[model samples]
Target: MNEQTKKQYTMAVLNLLQPKIASLVKEAHPVYQEDLEQELKLKMLEKMQTPFLHNIPSFFEFVSSNEKK
Candidate 1:
């Protein structure tokens, strides 16, 4: 992805994770809390770069895939 798209994607994911990250850092030592939050955000952004799926499955497609166990 281009730089602009990549940055936007990172920001969106980080925004979604902000609350969870805050909670996670809350229990950390006061001196380490900021560092812990930064590390968590960095890790999440790194993982998001990995490919997940190119497209979402439609209802019929999902049904067919799940049929016959």
Candidate 2:
């Protein structure tokens, strides 16, 4: 995808995950929440570009006790 399209896709994905990101940022310092959310979004966007997304894990995989490295 082109840069613009990749950016649009990233924004869409960020919008879809806004609630989850908010929840994840809730524990962060109030002053840093905004920055934390932006950083998390950037990280997620980076991950979205990786081969890791090809073999995506189930949602349960994240919260499970037996996570693989």
- Best-performing candidate as measured by TM-score: 1
lDDT of 1 by residue, 1-69 (tens): 588987897898799889989999999999999899989988887777667632567889989989946
Model 2 clashing residue pairs (backbone): none
Any runs in candidate 1 off by more than 4 Å, and if so which?
52-69
Root-mean-square deviation of every model: 3.6, 8.6
Clashes of each: 0, 0
lDDT of every predicted structure (CA atoms): 0.84, 0.86
Kindly list the per-residue Cα lDDT of model 2 for residues 1-69, writing each as its tens digit.
589987798789889999999998999999999999989988987889898775666779766836654
